[model samples]
Target chain A: MKFTINRSKFIKYLTDVQRAISSRTTIPVLTGVKITIDKDGLMLSGSDSDISIEIYIPVADESNQLEVIEEGGIVLPAKIFNEIVRKMSDETITIEVGENLQTSITSAKAAFNINSIDVESYPNFPVIDSNEVITLPTTLFKQVIQHTVIATSTQESRPILTGVNITIENGQLKAVATDSHRLSQRIIPIEVPESLKENSYKIIIPGKSLIELSKIVENQDTIEMMVTQNQVLFRAENLYFYSRLLEGYYPDTNRLIPANDSTKLTINANDLLQATDRASLLSHEGKNNVIKLTLTDDHVELSGNSPEIGTVEEALNYIEATGDPLVISFNPDYLKDALRTFGHQNVVIGFTAPIRPFTVVPADDNSDIAQSFIQLITPVRTY
Target chain B: MKFTINRSKFIKYLTDVQRAISSRTTIPVLTGVKITIDKDGLMLSGSDSDISIEIYIPVADESNQLEVIEEGGIVLPAKIFNEIVRKMSDETITIEVGENLQTSITSAKAAFNINSIDVESYPNFPVIDSNEVITLPTTLFKQVIQHTVIATSTQESRPILTGVNITIENGQLKAVATDSHRLSQRIIPIEVPESLKENSYKIIIPGKSLIELSKIVENQDTIEMMVTQNQVLFRAENLYFYSRLLEGYYPDTNRLIPANDSTKLTINANDLLQATDRASLLSHEGKNNVIKLTLTDDHVELSGNSPEIGTVEEALNYIEATGDPLVISFNPDYLKDALRTFGHQNVVIGFTAPIRPFTVVPADDNSDIAQSFIQLITPVRTY
Candidate 1:
């Protein structure tokens, strides 16, 4: 492979693909980024066993900086290649395959002769049909994923729970994730025409994959998401992100949600988040990591206790009481996750009882804002 | 105890004191911060076995805002106290001890009642003698610690090697740290005439302790250092940092450094660091992390390799070449550490050979600037 390309452009693509490169990969070749130069452009690929990312830099960019002399391929150590390209002291860097499998990279004040791996040893990436694609605004997709993915279970006991269940039904895209202790669901109500709505499309994407994909995407462009039975592909302008889908069926969570609550409290999202945060400091030290919430005729009290350390009780003054006052204890971390995921200006939390799960929804009377979104928090026994 | 103080002021002190508190202390009371209330002020104390930090918030500074009715004391869990104070929902937070060893923390729309431990269980901070004191610009002390501390051996094989040796003689502060493989020496030329000049003192301050002390002293302020036989005290404005000095005689490192070398290379600090960094990406994966620097009549080449992975050779454009051709291999990490510690813009590397030790000094025309500091790195045997 012999070529010269804009340094920043290569660096940008390297970063995009590097997210998929895990230093701890069992397969040695997987740790290397496969670089190929064809008639059209240059391609950089990085993969772990789970996910692979590929980014392309076309020769004909605005800078007219990429010039190709010979089209070939090589697999360079991902980390070394990345560092060399990043530190190249020129606007454009030149790379040429030398004898004994050496690849020479030259710039202004530096020249690196690196040994390249045989591209044949590297595993082939999964190829997908390009036709079945769902397009969405990159920024909106980022927001929806950010809001839903945090609730995904990090525990590997149930691998499927580590993924966010994304479903498209009736011109709406709803993403739901839960660890069974708490759940986060966000419905992007952006109008999709009938042709773009596919009824058979439902897939669960790993939260880690979604996070890396989110990093590779830009707000200015539209991202194409193509879902297969086993894999999901995200295609941006110059970057392609691929993630493996969870095989098991996601739980039917709709039945577990309560329709209405006997007691409800409305509070500023930031204020309640901060209060619960303080309550969490004490509860976080507890074995169950549970914080107690007590509602009375005048105010609501948030408290937590660690048997060895101490107890903390914080009262929220802005309380509107209607039904019999309620006191419930749940994981402060879960509640924090719910509030953080929603990131709404104001939220209304409705409680059924101390043992059952509670519901937190947008305070504004717009179900559209709360469309397919539902978070459930199971109270931990604090007694 | 009852008092209300500015939230920001309390948080600042809490942050500093938090540095002295560790969660894994063997002493249970060390996990708590002692809060004492008096007619003069409120004292917050946090300590680990080796180091202790204390801050006093005077009542008069509150300008009538801080109201203290009762004078009492308690040891609040350091982490909990910090979290509560940080997350309190008011501009001014009021903390008061309630009946039955409970502490009540009140803010605008919130009130936190936490359990407090008896103050008697907390260890009393020893008062070090303040009669012998040396004062210097905080910047100078901070720079002295920063420049020489990196060379301290991380291994506990020899406890004394893990501490930076500070020898105050003839009004000059000489700092030295070495891991046996490399040594960093820095001498201050300024002469301050006082008791500091009359008495010469040498003490080994634990590397970790100096790091903590460096944190307390801001670059802007002048700091006072009080030396006791067993402990060294660093005082800056409102914050006082006391650390127990390591007891042992530091080994003489002066004999290891060569008086002169036949071959020397002057290079840009930033460029050489980056080049070695690129070489390091491969060398770090090797056994001894060896990277070779080969200086020819024209240029310098940095190369590193692993038997299984590959090799990388980066050529640096020579600014000027006059010394005899030299080839030397050293642990890239040690060289990188020494390179980072040298604050000079350019570095002059004095070399002997592949198996010999080398010196790196500030590349300055002025003799005084170069004479003040020298960093030595021992070459590794790649064979």
Candidate 2:
């Protein structure tokens, strides 16, 4: 493409689209960033097999300092192009496609002529119904995804479990993720038009895609999402992020959470997190990676022991304790993750039995946000 | 051993000594830090076969924040102990050894009881003459090492090429390292006491050990060096860094550098560095990684090309160009290294024939410091 644009602006657009580019892609052309310059502006698109991103720089945007001298398209090697743009010291950089698919990039005293792939070989974008797009605040979207995405399974054996299942029903958006050992879920009250009130929607988005989407949409206020049968697109101001949807159904996890509890303990989140972290120091790998928690009348003891290494014990005074005194063992990493997901200052942990799963919720549930979030961890049987 | 020391001060000592510890050591005890608590204070030492570092915290040192309750010694696992000490919130941490090599680490409300190895199995320090030592400013020591260490061979085929050969004679300390493709040398003048004037010494210190020692001696003003038959110890105020010397004679690299030149180019160090970097973008790996430099009577041009990829060309105005116009090709990485190692603002490159190695020196070599540092890089035959 023949064009001249502000160097920093071009870099910003390149970085946004580069989030979806993978150097290890099986498709050779997927390693390039497709650049197109036409009547509208310059569009930079990058894709792995799983996700694709496109960021557009409109010619009318004065701050971008873009001027189109010729209309063309080219796919440049992602890594070399990125390096050249970053290392160029000039304020403005010019790119022109010459004979034999050779592209020359000139900036001040430096000029780079790199091979460009045919744009026709690039994959086409999936079709979507733009009229049925759903809009949500960027902040709420980022928060819900961050809290639940971490709990998703990393194994690809069960593809559905590797995604965060997002559902919209009764004017509320809920996101849940679980890897069987632990589960995290968050709900946000959203406003939808009356025409879509009776229609419920659920989509399982790959956790990995959500992480990349979060980084690209940081500066935007709202995002428009268009979901089709197989792919979902999240549109920001000048960026479009598309991810493939998992085909299988997500497991019904509502029945897994215990409804009643016999023992409860309220403690500071930081204190419990620290104690578990220290206890995990001695927990051996390839084993259960378990740490025990003993709740007594006056205090709680957290300890971890390894046959090869030694043991660690930490006792802390709880804010309040009730029900029968109990001892339980579980993977300390899961407990740490649960505590970290809770933004509240105090956490109230509920236990049904030593062998059963436990629930961690905010001690002060008066706030609307805290009332809608919950994290559950399944304990490991020490015996 | 039983002692309560200021947690932060203890952490500092542990960090310094921990640099010598490696998780991949074949010797089991080398992975553990030997901690000795006595009337003097606490001593922490770690070794990875190639190098060992010992840091002592004396009870009398100001702000060391140490107290000795009993006298004993034990070896603790480096990773676990470092983590426990770092995570403790208490200002003072008390460590007490119990029966059967069990250690109780108590800090505020937390206590960690960990396994400790028997101290008797740890390797003993090498014997050296305490009276005979060479001292130099830590800054000078750091500078000479940094300038030459990068040139050391990373391959294990020839073990001697991996070490930096340091020689002291005629009140001057000279350091040189080469990987056969490129070589770097630096010298610094110093005053030696009359008692040691007659003694001249040459030792090859492993480049990796010099890198670690440089980090530990950053805050110290002066360092004392003790060279024995097979080991060299770098001693700071309260720290001892011992590195095993590389045996066998070093190659005679003094004759490789050209003393006269038919062509010379004087250019800004940054300009040359940037041009070579851009040129390298198009230089393909495994295919020579070559970049060509064309020197004319007026301007210099740098260009690189790959058959599959394209080409890059950068032209820069030089301060001075003399002799005949020439076209030469060399690996850009080696040239970039030579220019980057020079501390001078501007670099003067001396060239003989296109096939001979070139010398990169400071353009303004009036100062004593500039005259002592020289770097040489071999050129690849382009034909």
The C-alpha lDDT values of all candidates are 0.81, 0.87
* Per-residue lDDT of model 2, residues A1-383, tens digit only: 58999999889888888889999999999999999999779899999979999898998899899999999899999987988998887999999998878899999889888888888999887877666767888998998888898899999888899999999888888899999889998888887878788878899999999999988896577898888888999998888899999888899988988889999999988888988888887785326699999998777899888877788888876799899899999999988888887654798999999988999988887747533888999999878
The regions of model 2 sitting more than 4 angstroms off are A367-371, B369-371
Go through the candidates in order and give the clash count of each.
0, 0
TM-score of each: 0.92, 0.97
Question: By TM-score, who's the top model here?
Answer: 2
| Predictions' DockQ, in order | 0.55, 0.81
Tens-digit per-residue lDDT, B294-363, candidate 1: 9888878888887655677777754555577988888888888888875447888887776789988887
Clashes of 2: 0
Best by DockQ: 2
- TM-scores of chain B alone in all candidate structures, in the order given: 0.94, 0.96
Angstrom error at residue A180, model 1: 2.5
Worst 10 residues of 1 chain A by lDDT: A365-374
* lDDT over C-alpha atoms for residue B70 of model 2: 90
